[model samples]
Target: MANKIILTGGGSAGHVTVNIALLPELTKRGWNMVYIGSEDGIERELMTPYTNVPYYAIKTGKLRRYFDWKNFKDPFKVITGAYQAYDIIRKEKPQVVFSKGGFVSVPVVIGAWLNRTPIIIHESDVTPGLANRIAIPFATKVCTTFEETSAHVPSQKVEYIGAVIREELLQGSAIKGRNTLFFTRSKPTLLVMGGSLGSKRLNEVIRDSLPLLLQEFHIIHICGKGQVDETLTHQAYRQFEYVTDELPDFLATADLIISRAGSNAIFEFLTLQKPMILIPLPTSSSRGDQIVNAASFQKNGYAEVIPDEQVTKDRLVQTVHQVYEQRSIYMGNMQKVKKRDPLLAIIQLIEKTALSDRSRNKKEK
Candidate 1:
């Protein structure tokens, strides 16, 4: 029988992208993959393209740090989701459960534990997110993109696997990207990504500084869904709510990137050798994981950091020019770093853990 695995993660695109990266490889290896996620999340939409993978949606509650009226109600939702996840795990009988940390993953991890399935969790940020922290006790192995994250996780469970970038991202065509966007090769291209949902501050600043920016470069702005401004269409500026299949091409075309410091996105930028300016989410908004991620990248000389609160029209414009001027230095620093096959490492770990569990079960029998 072929090995079967359950993949779970959601809430944001960051939580889901790693699992998406894993799908092709898992499928190629003949693993039967099932995805468990929230009833109506970006995960479901992202997984919709994979007709072969069975997607299971469960009810999940937001794991918030701050108190809200819903706080009292959400635990019950989490309990219900746990029950649903348990039922699905029992029915699917996957040998292993692989989770990318998000609130939706907690119940699934609990369910996998209840089912005596080996659970492997992937943490993308320099620090584990709340969901990963909650799930860590149940995980057989916790894979980390940043080596520094090992200090936060249980020492025995942590595996420093680095980033698992999507394979297609490395295959982007700059010529194809320019032709598709109708951008001229005469000017450098600037790609602004605020992540999957988009960044309101990034959108506002980029738009505000467009006149000055467009003079030097062609701009591709991936403003979040419904955030597109129809009024400000410039010849050198193109706006997209999001891109899926064409993302690789866009990444290929970008000479410089201005983005929020999501671990997955920034790591993808690093893998592609793109010089970037990172504006992390402020502590008031998030648990400040992005701040840590940005700092790490900056320390490695892979990126320039801009605190979210300090983002302004003049600062953004000036920073863009400075980063572009010193782009080669950043690229040189990135190229100096040795690359590892993290996807393969994680996959092998999953297989080894599952096999070990099976062997132990047989021995007990």
Candidate 2:
């Protein structure tokens, strides 16, 4: 019988992309893959293109740090989700469950543990998010993109595999990207992105700085959904609510990037050797994971960082010029870092864990 695996994660693009990256390879190896996620989530939309992979939706409540009225009611929803997940796992009888950290993953992990199924979860940030932290004890192995994360989680379960970049991203064509955007080769191209939901502050600052920036470079701004300013249009400026298929091309064409300090995104930029200016989400709005991610990248000479609170029109323009000027230095530092095949590493671990589970089951029988 073929090895079967249940994949779970959602709530944001970051939680889903790693699992997306794993799909092609797992499919090629003849693994039967199923996905369990929230009923309505970005994961559902992103996974729609994969007809072969069966998708199961379950109820999930947002795992929030701050207190809210919903806090009282969410535990019941989570309990329902856990029961639903347990039923699915019982029926599917997968050898292992692989999770990318998100709110939906908690119940799935709990279910997997209840079924005595081995579980593996990936953590992309410097520290485990609330979802991952809750699921860690149940996981057979916890893969991390940052080595420093070991101190925060169970050291025995931690596997520092580094970033698992999507294969397609490395195949992007700069020429194709430039042609699609009608961008010329004479000027540098600056790509700005503020994560999946988009950053209001980033959108406002970038729009405000466009006039000065457009003089030096062609700009592609992924301003997030419903964040576009329809009133302002420029010959050298292009705005997108989001880009799915065209993202690789855009990355290829970019000479420099100004983006939020999400770990997965920054690692992709680093892999592509794109110099960056990072604006981490402020601690007030977040648990400050992005701030730590940005600081790590800056320390490694891979990027520059501006605190979210300090981002201004003038500051953004100045940083753009500074990063563009020092682009080679940043690229050089990125090149100096040794590369590892994290995708393969994670796959090997999954296969190993699955085989062990199968062996133990057989021995007991």
- Each prediction's RMSD over C-alphas, in Å, is 0.7, 0.6
Cα lDDT, all candidates: 0.94, 0.94
Q: Which candidate achieves the best lDDT against the true structure?
A: 2
lDDT, candidate 2, 145-175, per-residue tens: 9989989878789899999999999999999
Q: Model 1 Cα displacement at 222 (Å)?
A: 0.2
- How close is every model to the real structure, measured as TM-score? 0.99, 0.99
Supply the TM-score for candidate 2: 0.99
Q: Quote model 1's TM-score.
A: 0.99
* Model 1: colliding residue pairs: none
